[model samples]
Target: MRRLRNDLPYTFRPARPKDWFRPPALWLNRHWLLERKYRVTAIEEQGFERVRELDATGDSMLLAPNHADHADPHLMMEIGRRYELPFHFMAAREVFEVSKRASWALQSMGVFSVDRDGPDVSAIKMALSILAAGKPLVLYPEGEIYHHHERLDPLHEGVASIGMKACGRVSEGRQVWLVPVGMRFLHDPSVEATFRDRLTRLEDRIGWTPKPKMDLDERILRLGQGVLGLKESEFQVNVAAGGIQDRLESLCGQLLEMVEARMGSDGAAGTAPERVRAMRYRIRRRLLDVDHPPGEDERTLLLDDLDRVFAALQAHSYIGDYLLAEPTLDRRAETIMKLEEDLLGFPLYPSARTARILAGEPISISEMLQRGELPRKGGASALTSLLEERLSRLIEVPAGAACSTELVSRQSGETG
Candidate 1:
């Protein structure tokens, strides 16, 4: 019932079988070939009968799936092409804003943008009309790609809203297929680490040095080349599992457990930025989920988290190197304290909607502890002694530097 007005004219077209041999169509098809060569095993098309039926009978439908990877759209495109159907995808503007070249390529491949932050009633109405008019729509129920598979957040009510609105009025015979796609990549998906250097090359190609203030998402994507690892095979074979989020969650759990084992090993404790990056490669594999939330088109929350986690890991690497080279133990401890304070003060969750925004600068820990960082214990005496034991050997620390024997006094003071 909602209308797109003049903003998006061809957005919601009536049922017409797409012949993809035309200009943008052919180019779009060619664009995904590299993906096919590197990442697809077999692009399977299910419900040929349904596709053919929709084409012949003008039934509008939406293809919905859990968002897992950046390549989710391409996977659908490859499958849609094999079936000879064109399904327009709904994505956030952020995905396309990398540049005109990238945005145009996505649009040409039958992908379109919906304003994620600002409300676009017209675009929503336009999308509804497309489904009502007997065309196909592709949407990622999770709304974003995660580096690793994790539990699905609750499904969004939007897809259902569109379906209910179009029932028979826009759709016929109540025939809509909720095609569940379970794509498993047979490669290491370091997504961030695998692609960091390549992304630097990309920046060089563009002849632009990124401002430190560039959008976090843009910086993450630029380095997202290694976000997923290289293909284990020239042809990626994906086996479709059952379509529910829980089933996918169970499968993801198994994969994550394996990832965790490799990440927490002693071998990865201290190293350079590259070594730390490799450590993150394994850690992210465990911490992040591969399965996307249901009914969302692409959630950036996880990617944002990945960026922070990786950045922290990188900082740790640098600090580790610094500590190893520092001449004195007191200075090293001060540096460590400084880093901790910086992170603690950064917005852990700045926005109301986003639960992980950094809030402010971190407190200096000596100040932090003095300000009662710990609830009950006044800095454990034995623990402090043990730490200072090794640290004393490294530097000419003052005689009373490790003295926390006044814990009894400190605790009483804190209580008051």
Candidate 2:
């Protein structure tokens, strides 16, 4: 250990439920925690006021927020700064480790790692400890930001998993809460001309094309600073208790049952890939729950991943980003080799567990692709010819529509 320099302290601090939403330390937060170059309205007075209510409750909390723009975390930090405690954010490892200032900002903001591609064991352990120690954590259940839409990426069970694990592990399952926070921003001038005016100009400067995520953040932060006009010292906070996860689960279960009850004879044309979707959804949800105000860099890694996924799906192409390789080991072959070690021919994928038992073996990407997960959205039947025409579709199509296009295409030969 080259002695932890002017960097952030590694020693874990004792945390309290309320402490989760405040700025971490004076040094890191003072001028720029959520400071902005532009002035906007609705920062502290409008948007974050709801979160203030959620934080005062005395329990180990899991703050789940809908992801809209990158400003989601930034806005959260603004509230935290006002209250004066930092969240232990679970962020991409590479993004955090890239530079000293970024690392310090993250560490001071209580940052940690959750590698999206690899095992997030360390991050998971870190999160459980924070809750066990009695602190609240923040996570984006959606896992990635998107165009603000009405539908949520069906609440991933991974969030439930973390809650389950933390509940048991934290003080033997005593005080645990999952706090849901929603932000409704009005960039439209009529709703809040004060916020809207600044928002438009900032959006122009940043050139978000449709919308820039950073500008959204700057708008909220500016509203927090300029519109609210805190005396550079005065700050306010509010907190409220939400029902336990069990209570929420019961309610959600009831709702789901009602939905299923009404779903009669909407005959299934195809089975939803429930198993695969559940797994992906869970991993993403878990990553979101365990991390806190992910700094800009970490946010980019995840956003980039989402972009790659969407691009691959839209283009009818296999997804692989040579540029964004995340495995610690340098070579791609090494990453594959590690996975091979675990499955011994089972195509374990991104894991090398149980290597000693099987000895040596070859990795299998085909097996993973066959299972409909390896290449991600590329595996969809409409996206992949093998899964579409050759497998299930042939059985369902009308007989006349099933013939090859070229076989009966001699229009001139049968000019009836």
Candidate 3:
């Protein structure tokens, strides 16, 4: 049998209430498990000192960060160590359910579960408890890793809702702060070659042969169009062409329409990410629990439906790369990484890449309440958009940075 590398080990602890924030074990995990083992090159701090100031004031806080990659949680831990702040993190229950030992370790480290697919009241209460205690809680609003560092996925409204609700729970004198954090992954320039090689390998594996002298943009367009084209064919979609973004959007809309039609559901409104979330919520209602466990044939049919749902979600999550109009070398490299991850199911980038942890100015719950933003109808949606806007600005790669657009241009088809 082939051997697979295992994750870091942890000792088990009985589930109970404890001082989860101030654990000496977390620092050890950050040093040995995250930085040393995972090779996190450096965390470029931006506006982190502001968080330090907030900590000194003893304000209750929740961090809503953009989820770009798998390493974000660990990177945030390292950030916490540097700032001398301990935080409680909200994690998906399935992570704790991976193994008993893993569950115990994470739970010991001030991590609590929030069921993403369903209403978990206990999890909600736990989050409120932490906030009411005046401790900082890190809640990722994006909900899952979308693998685009510069893009902010549509946020889940739960973050804003919880923050406002927790604010109300706090004493009149105390404040609950919602801090927006942007985790941007930056890699070495040499990785451009790596990206190209990887893309070439993927193209070969998928049996795609680009026309001679194709520019980088054209090649990328062709590759993306090809993938989308296949999915369209599978769904019996009439081919629509108007560059990558237009066609991809149309295809996803059609797919979602088909999904909603099958489920006897309507209201496929909002952006792709929003539609996907709504669709998944409906899907969960059907699949979450069955009184009787399904037979083999029943399980296969159920699995097929799930596969389609997830595929649609992924298509929605990933199409944001089209937003990059000025594709620099860094942007192009990251795009290739996206392709590698999406196509070959590979890591987005090497582990040794530097992560820029950008913390925007914390939004004051008191101020928001006074401004009539909190507790208002559609307030959560508005606040989420505001947070997302802050994150988008924070992750913006400087246009003046030394990146070779020529490299990308050279790789494109002649028409590009």
* Strongest candidate by lDDT: 3
In angstroms, the error of model 1 at 340 is: 23
List per-prediction Cα lDDT, in the order shown: 0.39, 0.37, 0.67
Candidate 3 residue lDDT tens string, 310-351: 566656665634535767765676666666766776554543
RMSD of 2: 27.3
Ranking according to TM-score, highest score first = 3, 2, 1
Q: Which parts of model 2 are misplaced by more than 4 Å?
A: 1-40, 44-58, 149-151, 188-310, 313-416
Off by over 4 Å in 3: 1-39, 208-217, 266-269, 292-299, 320-324, 371-377, 397-416
**Tens digits of per-residue lDDT for model 1, 1-416:** 00111111122212223345334554344344323323332222223444545456665656655553344566566555445666777776555655777666666555667653234465577677666666778765444443222223233445544444444354325343333333323232232232334334445544547444554334533322221111111112232254222222333333333333434533523322233334434433433345733223223433333343333332222222232344232322223223222333211111111001001111122323335642224333322232223222312222323212111224324321
Which stretches of candidate 1 lie above 4 Å from their native place?
A: 1-38, 44-51, 149-151, 171-177, 188-416
In candidate 1, position 92 carries an lDDT of 69
What TM-score would you give candidate 2 relative to the actual structure?
Answer: 0.40
Pick the winner on TM-score between candidates 1 and 2: 2
